[model samples]
Target: MSIDSTRFILLNTSHYGNIGATARAMKTMGFSDLVLVAPRFADALVHEDTVAMASGAADILVRARVVGSLAEALDGISYACATAMTPRDFGPATHAPRPLFAELARSEHRVAFVFGSERFGMANDDVYRCHACISIPTHPDYGSLNLAQAVQLLAYDWRQALGGFEVAPRVPDASLADGAQVQGLLGHWQQALTDIGFLDPAAPKKLMPRLNQLLNRAELSAEEVHILRGIARAIQRRG
Candidate 1:
């Protein structure tokens, strides 16, 4: 699927902030096309809530269009996917985003992801016409999702199928504590626990083994080992 050819269609959005937030979400995933199908407000495209939510992605909103109907919104799209729960009976097949997007990525289809309004989702009639329904798996107890959040998730998964950007570390990873450093910390901790009578050498009873397991699970850094050793020293002094 062409990222440029993909557009997000919000159907009858009631909340204006969601419109702006959706623009921001689309921009982050390298999607630019945003079409609103009959938003509640006439000036939704330029609404302050939309602009404020767009943040650095104001360009997306500037290029966004407002349409009267889904048919008009999907004018040039080859495949349209509705974002909603699967129809229990007989409608389009419902798929999770990743697998569906991966399948779509193999083709040159111009896809549009249609989202329903925040209050009431898309009509069954509207969903029946789509090629497939895309459902983001959520807890069975509560599946309610914020509109922009759903857009962000679908956009991210679709972008991943199209080869996402590599993550760059903001800071270098911390140096890990070597076995020798860990052994030293363990020895120091042993002394502290023994002095405090928390562990009796005569009747250790798996206490040291349990502490070892705890530290091993912690996956300590070298700096953390040194800090822990200092605490052990303090404990011994207090004892």
Candidate 2:
């Protein structure tokens, strides 16, 4: 029940925002201990950008421990879990985050969740040092997640396994975009395609409808719709 005993170790973190976001994610889930192993920026934890990105979780950043090596980070850890999506011929067996957290939740000993650099995940030796590997179940074609997102997912699952924390209710009736919004997105895509010469308006086949169907199936949220629209605008600008 003492989640504080579990540490969140970040190795060679290259981005200040990621470090800050990781702190926010850990604090949101009630986990505090953070260890950074030779981060790219020596003062990332205290950087203004990092503090800004941490939102209201700056306390975690203030108390974060920095070490010169992974060994130092794992000094007192009883069990360690490496968050690495890639498979290795040798090393700890990869387990999905939920089940792994469920098992770790029962342990009273100190535990650590180890994450690696954004460009490349944990080195083979580091992965080998862990008792287990945690891979968040993601689409096979696109399994890559940002460093902070990965931390958030694992933190959320681990927190849930530890009886979970209360979160505020979402706004009522605020969900994925409705039909009109989808259509608008499709229209934007159509113009973008035409502007980029990807689709010939005169000789257009069923491509637009097909794309519309694909978008509909995606159940895009309002934010996603806005992102797609922004992409379309970018395409138009470039065209």
The TM-scores, one per candidate, come to 0.71, 0.69
Worst 10 residues of 2 by lDDT: 165-174
Instruction: Kindly give the number of clashing pairs for every candidate.
Output: 0, 0
Model 2: how far residue 135 lies from native, Å: 0.7
Q: For residues 49-156, what per-residue lDDT tens digits would candidate 2 score against the true structure?
A: 999999999999989999998989999889999988778998899898888778778877688999999988899999999999988899978888999999898888
In order, what lDDT does every prediction score? Answer: 0.90, 0.91
Stretches off by above 4 angstroms in model 2 are 167-239
Task: Determine which window of 10 residues in candidate 1 has minimal summed lDDT.
Answer: 83-92
- Candidate 1 C-alpha lDDT tens digits along 1-239: 45679989999999889999999999988999999999989999888888999988889988989989888998999899998764647788999899999999989899999999888899887787689999999999998889999999999999999989799899999999988999899999988999998888998898778888889899999999999999998998899
Candidate 1 has what TM-score?
0.71
Compare the candidates by lDDT and give the number of the best one: 2
**Model 1 Cα displacement at 27 (Å)?**
1.3
**Which one wins on TM-score?**
1
